[model samples]
Target: MDIKFESKEAERQYLKERLAAGFRIFAKYGFDEGPAGHISLRDPINPDAFWVVNPFGLHFALIKASDLILVDESGKVLEGGANRHLNLAAFMIHSAIHTARPDVNCAAHAHSLYGRTFCTLGKSLDITTQDSCAFYNDHVLYENFRGVVLDEEEGIAITQALGDKKAALLQNHGLLTTGGTVEETVFWFLSLDRCCHSQLLADAAAAGTGGATKKIGDKEAMDTWKVVGSRKGGHFAGRALFDLIEVETKGDYKN
Candidate 1:
């Protein structure tokens, strides 16, 4: 299939809206902490580039649709429309994923509380509930904590760790999720965070007992996926996230 590039004006507008939608979703779910997480969309024209990412120091709740800073796959800032510096880790992580996975059009990374907790344990979430079933057959665990990823090679390693999985837990760090659309990618991130949160709550309720370790039957997991994943091929969940964000944030994701 041939990929088409949007007009410069259209690309900028589409990216602005999609990015704002992502930031709003993150904020609505309390996934961001003082600009600690990032999301990016692949440029419609450039296979080797993506739109401007959430810049360094911009709080998720306060990010505007027009504040995005365009960056290349090589981590160079092509346009800082908002006069902000790009987050190094955003470039490192997102650029690597976009380069390695041409099929993924959007990527999200965050250090949400529960996601970090699960990642620190280096364990994949079992298909223990409907919420966790989304990743029942696909997910990865990258346990090598190589400090902060300050270079492109580390980013490449992170992408390699992700492999074909839609989600990956960055050990000692947090979580990363990708998708064919910005909406899908944001939905996956939200699901991962919620799943981690649900698991944590279950563990707390179990009082550290084995109740937390109980796994959903494989058949049931498959059934749950059929219900959730097959719902317009996840377009429902993705759009729902977008709508929820708009409602929660008073229709103002762009500040």
Candidate 2:
């Protein structure tokens, strides 16, 4: 869909609102994980900078458009207040991604329960279900884990590992997903977590039965991805989720 804005401010507002909504929806679904996760969007007016959630203390559910912090490429807070700080790990990871991939307008990283568990196996999601097919040949597995990602070198390594992929499973860590829009990126994060949950359940069942689960062929999986993994599909899914959250929270996030 072609999004037309009356002015630059309107576009910036649209981006801010969506970024806030993404945080709230992630919190609603238990993706917050004790201030460990972050969702970031490229600044609408300044492509070299991005906006991210405040560091380490604020609850994701309570985040509003006005609560977001705008940061430059060097991880310096430019627009948000002095009390608001950006997480070093968030800066290391997201900055690398936004710098490396100009096409990625938004990047989401979270230590979700199932996603973390699935990452321990050092494997990508298999095409066991149609939903899993969304990641078929589209995700990467970052097999190296060098403790906490505090250094720029670690972040650059991750960026190289995630080259041109939509999602990445960080070994012994968690999941990272990127997209052209906040809605699409958030939806992919949600979908990836669900796929991880489904895969774990399937593996347990197959282990008990001593039988292998059926798999979809590469061609079929790729074809299904075209329909289910498109940015348009993700945007629609995210909008549906945002609508539900708006009703549940009574649009409090807009404040």
Top-TM-score candidate index: 2
lDDT tens digits by residue: candidate 1, 92-164: 8888898888888888888898899878777877677787888877678888888877888899898998898
Give the per-residue lDDT digits (tens) of candidate 2, residues 1-255. Answer: 368999988998888888889998999889977778898899979899999887456899988888888888998888863467678888899999999999999999999999999999988788989998888888999999998789999999999999998999999999999999988898999999999999899999999999878899989998999999887888878778878888888878776
Candidate 2 — which residues are off by over 4 angstroms?
Answer: none
Tell me the TM-score of each prediction against the true structure: 0.88, 0.96
Clashes of each: 2, 0
Candidate 1 residue spans exceeding 4 A from truth: 1-8, 207-212, 230-232, 247-251
- Judge candidate 1 at residue 172 and give its lDDT: 86
Question: Worst lDDT window (10 residues) for model 1?
Answer: 1-10
